[model samples]
Target: MIILKYIFKFYIPCILLITAVTVVLCVRKPYKKQTVNRVVFNERYFRKISGTEKEKYLDSIVTSLNDERNDSVSRDLYLKAGEEYYYLNNIRKSFTSSQIALNLSREAKDSSRIAKSLYFIGDCYENSQKDSAYYYYLQAQKIYTLINDYEKLGRMHFNKAYVLFYDGNFVECEIELTKGLNYLKNSDNEKLLYSCNTLMGNCLEKLFMYEQALKYHQYALGNLKEMKKNNLDSDEVNNFNVSSVINICNLYDLKGEYSKSIKELNAVLTKDLKKKWPRLYANVLSNLAYSKMKNKEYKNVEFMFLESLRIVDSLDYRSDAIYKKIYLGEFYLAQKDTLMSLKTLKEAYRSAVEMKNTNEILRTLRLLTKIDNRKKVFYANRYIDMIDSINSIRSKISNKYARIEYETITVEDENKILTKKNFYILIFSFAAFLILLSIFGFVYLKYKNKELKFVKQQQNDSDEIYQLLSEQNEIINKAKEEEKNKIARELHDGVMNKLYGVRMNLGFFNTKLDDKSIEKRKEYILELQNIENEIRTISHDLSRDSFLEGSDFNTLLSNLIANQKGLSRARFKYIIEENFDWEQVQNIYKINVYRIIQEAVLNIHKYSRALNAEVKIQLSEDKILKLSILDDGIGFDINTVKKGIGLSNIKERANSLKGNLDILSGIGKGTEIIVMFDITR
Candidate 1:
């Protein structure tokens, strides 16, 4: 199936080109429009213009392009403007101009320009600006499909793979990357092929498909070799060669072939490419050092790691430098150099924490655990804490994906019902045609039969639609119960375990307290007590009993506000009207409301830069809960700001609860969120 897809993808462009030729041959007069003078200026002029001058230049171009008298010229101008803005990293402006270009191209029915604009839009979205990156990539994918532009289609799929990865959907990412490779299989575009294979290998590795990943990396290497053979000495080709080599080395390291890995790294180094590519060199050195460390060549590993560290430090790049430090610490730990290992591992651990490298931190913590018995307890506790936190996050991501799938299936079922209904309508029309032919044989009899058939068909259609709706509702109910269980498990297994362990640790220390040591023990006890308090705060609100009883709504809100008050400097103003009938609320609806408010308040406190905020919950007479959350802050335009997981969570939860949520905010204006949901007794 996959090979067939590749073949079809390759042939689609040729078919499209033939169709284009046929259209052009059949058509007589082609419309001609005036070319815009604005298209003559390049990105260099925009770069030369400073501050307000640059803004003025852009503004004049936009105004001139907006002139209704110059539609074709306007489109060309917009495309040029978009290119300039894209170069400047002004993604918002670039996206706007590209969208304008797309609109114009669509209006003109120009397939080539439409494809080009879509490609630019995809590029803009894939860059730093985050809003609807996936959406834009998907849009570009559809446009490329229409134009049968396989190269752009492959690029779009690759970008979608990245989005899936960031969303923690590694399985989906690997699948999408495979689709990308299939789309580009027969293409002569060596750069695109290399990129697709490398990314596929990376995602496969992340998914723990080591053998498959190595195969893809090797495939990429083969392409690079072919490109070289073709006499294309592009820097891009060189970069791909180096990357494929590194991926191959890493795969070997994972496979426990440390010796072979070192050989691959050495080969890259022998190419004299180290000086020209410091980052890659540093990474290669770090990997080679790790391989040596595993092979028990302590002295050699030390020197190699130090070189990598020095290079990374000089280049001011800490990503690989942190890895080198951790490896060096591991080497010292293995040698039983306790003092040096402790100091080195501690620094490495700090760097890992600062860099947010969970894997490195986990490794360093394990090293710390194997050191002196005195600090072994602390290190062991930290290791367990990190593991639990990771597990909790994994569980959360799984639950989110599961919910997304459930909702998707529900939509499919609903669409199926609509399709079935249309089918029945078509059948009814065919029956009417038969009746018209048989009208002479039986006039009133034919009419009676037709009416009966129509009535029966309507009943069947209604039954099917009703059945689908019921099934959808059942799926949603099951998902809610599962989600509730997952949340409970996270609370009990994660936060509760840490709190218990810390308290137990403090209890053990309490027995050995001397006069001076008593203060230190008490300090540790205080820290543990604070952690316990936080757990209790979260537990009290997240409790299954209160949620099931539906009496915990007010308590949950109060706890959140109190927690925020304790954690932040901003004053929190929370208001709940007396009309709130907690006892009558449904558990799922209550939980959804609580989570939405929790996410919203956290975002406001963390990112709003607000001094004050207000939250209001009111039970309306229509058996609905109306929540109005407001914040007086340096707000953002919802239309422009990219919605992340937290905001997505709020929206998703609201959808799951069959509620409506509207967000109103602009630059300097405060944010006001209104959520309304029916909650019947």
Candidate 2:
């Protein structure tokens, strides 16, 4: 019995322990084998895959490594898949794969891979989602900058600027392009540099900076010419050359040199760009047709338009087709073929609406209103509403651009300050070292050190003064440019459009001079009188010196109010503190105050639907200038309604003058704006 108990306890426990160890080993052996098999399979798969099989091979690898812990290999596989998908034009898949790669790279803390993945994702969305593309590009730019990857950084900036240009944000686009050019100054990427210059030219063209635009375009063209001379010719280089020619032609067209535009387009047409680059070729043809139309070569205009349309249709270029249809409609209208014109225009309008092209829709609507008088009122109302909405959106874009410019300038100024400080520190450190050496060598060196210190101090002072002068000059130049733009807009929208209306009315009156000729003549006389009043109002607004030379502050306010009353339906009243001396206020302060009031009144006239408005100006005994504008209009909710360009301008003017502005308004009530400035400050 004792032997049996010992055997059962000791031997049985030993057998159970051995069996547990065997079971654990047996379970781990298959896992190890599976891992080894997977690695070998991945290796074999990669080796067997051809370049054309990259996407398929990548997919298999990704699936096999989905639960694997090797992040580096996984991220690389995802990146390859993304690149292959991008080339295949599967942007959604490309974006998804790149995003996965980006996340994996981030987890791995791989900056280079992160940047590459971000750039790939940006490219995938560049055409469809501009804002998202810009976001990713900026993210990639930060990584590139951190890594000091200047080439990729320059490319990122260039890409972001292209998207901005597409959004019509030319100011910010130019800023970004300028930054890219600075980074690419010594880079050997001639193609990227050429692209940067070309895009900069386009931005400048849109901003109406034509001289600079032409210079940039010429620079790009010269680069291409140099590349050609070096036998570095490819389809891409040839296409760039063709595009540069087209851009120059478009610039010429914008500048009203239609003959030069046509000549350049003809030169482009001589190259056989049709087969290799059909879209570009079609664009050139359409531009050529438009230039010919503008030059009044009516004989070839229809044929050119038709040929361009045919090419566009063959390529299934819907956007270009929409514009082409509009051109055809215009051509038929000019030829007095009302039936064909209506047909083409309706089709164009439908296409534009479907495409969500606001500019084309507006153009089509206006043309329809002119062609079909039965629907004139309907189309005219739509046109006006669209114009207003477009204007509002453009105003917001301009504000955003100004903010970007200001922020860029601020950063530049800070960098300059930092650089100047570092330079001074170096000089001072050197001087101190020299003083220490002199202390050990010669007693006369003390005076020499003092002289050096004084010289350095003088140089620093001079540099500071120069910097200040430069900053002031920049501010003045910016102000001048803004004023010029404002004047141009006023002339174009207010004066020019009115004059065009007068001309059209005169044309109609001249055509219909039957029994109602006298009544029509009377109406024409009244329109001329209205035009004269408008001209007078503009003259008064521009006549600032006359009001400021010796006139009282009340007189200036009175003149502005009178101009508004003449130009608008709103009644205006002015109340001013007696015995206030406007001449005591600084010229700068007075100018900004005048502008603020002018902008506020204009807003009231344009948007407030106000019947009566009042202005109050007071100079307190403590030399505080107080100005208030009260309008009995259909007021807006100040908290809910975003400020428009006019209100923003008023606020900016107030800030420039070191004033406090308070705007109070509520729906169904009235708006009251009050501004206060301490002239003593």
Candidate 3:
């Protein structure tokens, strides 16, 4: 009733104005100048129409505006058309119209409008063309930054965070996404605030922070609903609310709560599906299929998948279709139709690879293995191979994330320190202000005999600031010394113990005599040989330089290989790509790279197996060094490998040098290690 009232109220005035104009023209046969004014006034009245009539009114306005060469009117009409197409999920057309709007905006030299248009263009490709979306988002972010429009910048960051999520850098992505949310928290921009909240919720859900995820999703939903209630004509509010539902549904699905996911999805279906939001419809259908499959409703699953595919195909959604095929392959595999499963899975894999969708590629590979057990051993072997390959990639990402986190934490810590410093400075300044105020007051009060009290208060405040500064300095010094001591203890206890054993073994061999018998002579000879190897090993361990001061690049590597002698069952080999003198490589990069490899090898020896191992280093044309340590043994799942102390240490060391490390391994196969870094002497 309210919607109808709104429509009628807006249109009735336009109709009355048109009728009055007709009456005036028919009754008065206006003078020539008056006729021109009437026509212009009547055309202006037509522009006041609303609802469906408003679209026609705008179109008519656009025609008249174009005839008058009104750039501003044309730009507004283009933006409206683009928005309508976006609402209808005519993404390609929306993109085209937005591009036209962007060109117009650029000509108008309106930076904000250009950024807004670029954001829409980014939205069009965000799901299917991630790289392109990221590029456009970056372009938009640049403009937003130039204009100091932080709200748009935050939205761009949110979009970039999603791209990173798709690229499989979930940790760093979470960081950036959180940064965006933080920005929104300080702003009142409705669109950016809602987007940041929803995307942050998605990120938290992916990280398994379900409760926090729900909170943010609910926050977004509540905000969106409030906005919608006040402004029914707002397409953004409608889309935002629908999107919140979709995100909640996805989160429930990830948590394996199929019923909840279905409930949310069904709610969206009843609300938005019939309202002509086709992309939203497709997304809901895809999610519904996911829940149904999870619930083992295979027949219904296939139906939903097909429905999603049909809709997405109609829209030429190449990536969406590929994903649906991935789901279908999963469904077929569940039904034990191996041939169909293999065919569908292979197609999905190819498409994903072509699109450079690493996550999808991993999924398809996993499903493909289930389709044919005859290929099981082969696939398992390859899966192990992929484990290493994927692990290496994952390791690089992990290191990147760790570095990002470390840098973030460092910045935060530094900020905290700075904040403390600022607080002290503020305290000092405030005390100074108070003292000056007191002095002024004292001078004024000297006439009234109150100077003593004011002077005493000033002294007390100044003393308090001085005391606070002293305490903070003492605390900082103590912390620094404690941290240094902790590091020293770790090195002494961990590495020194091993070195002492080597020394003891050498000492034992030095005392043994060979004069007793032939057997005694032979035993002594073997003992001496063992002692010599021990001495060499110890020398390698002790001779290595610190990462802080850097090591001799060539010697750092040779020492690494020699330390492997401690592992009884392993045989080691080294392959350096270049014949150039190892001294040419910088010391700073070599030690850290070697330590990363050392840590990986140590993990392998302790957990993988004492078996055949290989270390290869290649210096590429770009001065990029690739180092790998591979071992043939029982390899564990890299995905399941938690960032333990050793792995964390490895990653931290690698990150300090801005290098990359990759670990690949699986059960009964071998572990492959790869590290890459640039060398700067």
Best by lDDT: 2
Please give, for residues 1-681, the per-residue lDDT of candidate 1 as tens digits: 685455445544444455456546655566567554543445677777776677568767876666443356667778877876777778888889999899889877877677768767867866564335665666567778888888878888888787777666788788788888888887888877887788888888987789999998988888888899888967667766777888988889887788898787777774356767877777887887888788776667778888889988998887677767877887887887878878878888898899888988998889888785788889878987998998788777654534544665687689999997875565445445455443333344447668998999999999999999999999999988977865664454335434544454456556775775587567557767766665675555655444335345577678657545533445788898865667777777767777677777767866788888888888765587888888988889886799986677777777766788899999989788898997852
Total backbone collisions for each predicted model: 0, 0, 3
- Residue 167 alpha-carbon offset, candidate 1, angstroms: 3.7
Give the higher-TM-score candidate: 1 or 3: 1
What is the TM-score of each predicted model, taking all chains together?
A: 0.51, 0.54, 0.42
lDDT of 2 by residue, 100-151 (tens): 8888898778999999999999899889987778877887988999999999
* Models sorted by lDDT, best on top: 2, 1, 3
1-681 in candidate 3: lDDT tens per residue? 685456455644554465456546655743433111111314455456554664455445434543443255566666666676676666876787788878888977878888888888988988888767776787787788889887778888888898887666767677878777765666766656676677778778877788899888998877776566666457667667778887887778776688888877777675446467777788788878888888776667788888888888898878888878988887887788878888888888889889877667777777777666677666556665766887787676555534543565577689998987765564345345345324443233344444665787899999999999999999999987966654543354335434543454444445666554445445445655655664554445443343324545666566667656645477777777657456766665655666566666667667776478888888874467888888888877876877777777766666667787777777677778677777742
In candidate 1, which residue ranges exceed 4 Å CA deviation?
1-38, 41-88, 102-131, 398-681
Candidates 1 and 2, the one with greater TM-score = 2
Q: Is candidate 2 or candidate 3 better by lDDT?
A: 2
How well does candidate 1 score on lDDT at residue 521?
65
Q: Please report the TM-score between candidate 1 and the true structure.
A: 0.51
| Worst 10 contiguous positions by lDDT, candidate 1 | 436-445
Off by over 4 Å in 3: 1-183, 186-192, 204-214, 231-246, 256-325, 331-340, 343-359, 373-681
The number of the candidate with the highest TM-score is 2
Error of 2 at 533 (Å): 26
